[model samples]
Target: MSASSAKVRTITRIAMFAAVLAVCSQIAIPLPSGVPVTLQTFAVGLVGYALGAKRGPLAVLVWCAVGLVGAPVFSNFMGGPAVLFGKTGGFIYGFLPMALLCGLAAEKELPGRIFLSAAGLLLCHLCGVLQFSLLTGMDLLKSALLVSLPYLVKDLISMALAERFAAALRRIPAFAHTKC
Candidate 1:
């Protein structure tokens, strides 16, 4: 492919992932606990790992912007400025930096390793929990115990599974240009 065509193809792929992320956000499985663990984050982490630093965060930015526009593109089909300002707002906004940080870690020479990806996801969880507590007036420790800890195993498994899935996707003709 020509250089410009390759670039366009790459952008198209990133946009596709962003759309997927938005859709994933809408499919929420409400937990008994106040925190609903959505598969959207799994897509966020996967985008970071699969698209590398630059395109990955760009994809997330697109997803977030779409969600902010009252698109019902978030967990529980929630969106709009109110959603951004709501108790879980921080976690929603936090996804940007989290995805970027994880993407950077997943793209860096040493940082892009699987271990770093895992660690980056852990940090994302921490940031989300802390922000969640601050927004909800809950204790940080309590937030961690209630919201973050329970999701640890699941997130780890999801990240690992995403890594594997991304690897396989990269081998496909259509997704060949995606960086995994």
Candidate 2:
């Protein structure tokens, strides 16, 4: 491919993954604590392995920027600056590091990948717990109990599935021969 085309391809992929994340975020089941069960984590995890460390985070950043600018790209189709800095904002911001860490997982063997991905999810949960606690005036333990703990198993499963899906994506012709 020409240099310009390659750049276009990269941009297109990033935008596409950002859209994927937006769609995933919208698949939310709202709860009493204001946290929602969504495929956002699954898609973020997929982005890391599918796009690699650098590009995955770029895609996530794009999604975040869109939402921050008032696009309805967050859970339950809600968005804007309010979502970015609101009750569950920590988890939203956490997606950055989450993608980065999961991207790093893509470089490892199966065990290491799972470990890193789990760690990344833990980090994301920690960010959520802290923010949820502070914003809601709940105790840290209570926030964790309510939001983080309940989701660990499901989120881990999502990460594993994301790895498989990413592997499948890598088998596609466009991804097979390209360094990007």
By lDDT, who's the top model here?
2
> Any runs in candidate 1 off by more than 4 Å, and if so which?
104-112, 177-180
**Candidate 1 lDDT by residue in tens digits, 125-180:** 77778777888788989888888898888887877777777767768877775454
Residue 164 shift from truth in candidate 1, angstroms = 0.4
What would the per-residue lDDT of candidate 2 be over residues 38-77, giving only the tens digit for each residue?
9999999998888878898999999999999999999999
Each candidate's lDDT (Cα)? 0.76, 0.88
RMSD of candidates 1 onward, in order? 2.3, 1.3
Q: Quickly count the clashes in candidate 2.
A: 0
* Native-to-model Cα distance after best TM-score fit, residue 70 in candidate 2, in Å: 0.3
Error of 2 at 100 (Å): 0.4
The number of clashing residue pairs in each candidate reads 1, 0
Clashing pairs in 1: 106-112
* Candidate 2 segments exceeding 4 Å error: 109-111
